[model samples]
Target: MLKKSGLSFLWLSAVAFVIDLASKYLVVKNFQLYESINLLPVFNLTYVRNYGAAFSFLAEHSGWQKFFFIGLALVISGVLIFWLAKNPINKKLQNTAYALVIGGALGNMVDRSYHGFVVDFLDFYWDIYHYPVFNFADVFICIGAGLLIWDSFKNKETSE
Candidate 1:
């Protein structure tokens, strides 16, 4: 049987997933494809779709990348769930990391299934340097990965 704290992680995942989906929905409803609405000197809301992995890797491939990413996200999400369920009680940082990753994966999975591409709108750039356009799901994943790394280091420190 799962512990009570385990459910909290799932709840966190649900919130992240909902927020990501809502953001994507608003972007799709309001912006045209490749439309840019300047939000600040270094930021903009530019709607675009990614049919590839991070930084648009393989985006130009002959359409096979879509299924590949979808499968990858699903498999990753499943592994996260398994890890979450098996986590030690009260392991807050580890749980949070899993929740964020699982939520992000499922959020993008929804996009991959419904639109055949991941919708991205948040854009940041300098005059001549532009970061890759990304969405909330990507944010969650990055943050989660960071936390996981932090957790590992903290655990190592405590054991040393």
Candidate 2:
């Protein structure tokens, strides 16, 4: 039987996965690669395929980066799942953090396995500066990471 925390984690992960996939589908079906539709002065819906990790790391490599990223994500996801399983029922925030990261990792893993790249659309920029284009998966992953950091601090304070 799934523990309360475990079930909650799974549910959050499922929701994140669905949203990520749906958004990616909408972007890919509507926009051509490298195309952009401006939504605000600093934001746009831009379709881009990243063959590497965050900030296009190792994108210049010939082809091995695909498998490397896939393997890395898979390992990280497995670890997240294990961590969530061990979490206590009352640790909602930590469970949520794990779930978000797991879901996001799986989402990008799907893209890397099928398309050899991850599809990114959300874009933010200033007049001459820009953030890396990313998708819902990346957003969730970042949020999860932030939560993890916050929880760590909270735990440390409580322990002292």
Candidate 3:
């Protein structure tokens, strides 16, 4: 069971990494920064590079933000990997969530380490209000977080 769980985590992580890298590559190769291709009335693919954490927070910090974020991601990823290794195999959902997080963090870490920023392409806007541009890795990270929350609630209810 432990071996199976490890393999499952590895497989999911690989898939997530590939998807994130491929999307970023396509965005970089096919579109220039700030170029928008409308896919829906409310959604578009806008090439962007984010140098900070989620939602572009601290994006304007003087230079040091890159090293800070990269170091933070590495620490987070290492913790998640350790947790996943320690967790019981029966906790499949929890392990999967950890895998998603690890994958997403590593994906963005790759960008930050190599390109000094994450390449974001997906964009959503309603009238004049625009959400920050993000990419597939962000989606995985958000979904993983939601699932982890749900799993925690479920376990709490089960225990009670």
Candidate 4:
């Protein structure tokens, strides 16, 4: 079962990271704070900054959350790197999931470090309600989390 090493998939992580950063750069350059451009009835490119975790959790804190999140991402990133290095390459789903997560963590970490917040642009809304605006890093993280959940069910089935 142990064929190649999971590190072989690290490129996926890099790809995620680059895409997140590039998309962010484009948004930052082309939009101002609170700017919104409707691309569809339910979607828009809106520039915003997230000061806390998902849904701006603890976003009202007195700035301590920034450092807290950065430190947390660092710990998570280290743990992911260790896991990926030791994981067997045959576990494609697991490794790919981890890689995407690493990329997301790194992307947000850099944003928190350099800009004090995560850049958010994608926005979806109903006629009068809107979901939280998010970016590519969040996208990658969510996708990774979904894959992890799927892998867990799959592994459980195989084991039983």
Query: For each candidate, how many residue pairs have backbone atoms clashing (under 3 Å)?
Result: 0, 0, 0, 0
lDDT of 4 by residue, 5-124 (tens): 888888999999999999999999999999999999999999999999999999999999999999998999899889888999899999999999999999999988999999999999
Q: Over 4 Å off in model 2, which ranges?
A: 1-7, 157-160
Model 1 TM-score, 2 decimals: 0.93
Question: Residues 92-124, candidate 1, lDDT per residue (tens digit)?
Answer: 999999999999999998998999899999899
**Which clashing pairs does model 1 show?**
none
TM-score against native, each model = 0.93, 0.93, 0.92, 0.94
| Cα RMSD (angstroms) for every candidate in the order listed | 1.9, 1.8, 2.0, 2.0
**Candidate 2, residue 137: lDDT:** 94
Between candidates 2 and 3, which one is better according to TM-score? 2
Best by lDDT: 4
Query: How well is each residue in 46-123 modelled by candidate 3, as lDDT tens digits?
Result: 999998989998899987999988888789888888887777777888988888987898899898888999999999
Count of clashes in candidate 2 = 0
Single out the weakest 10-residue window by summed lDDT for candidate 3: 1-10
- Model 3 gets an lDDT of 0.87
lDDT of 2 by residue, 80-139 (tens): 888877887788888989999988999998988988999999899999898999999999
lDDT of candidates 1 onward, in order: 0.91, 0.90, 0.87, 0.93
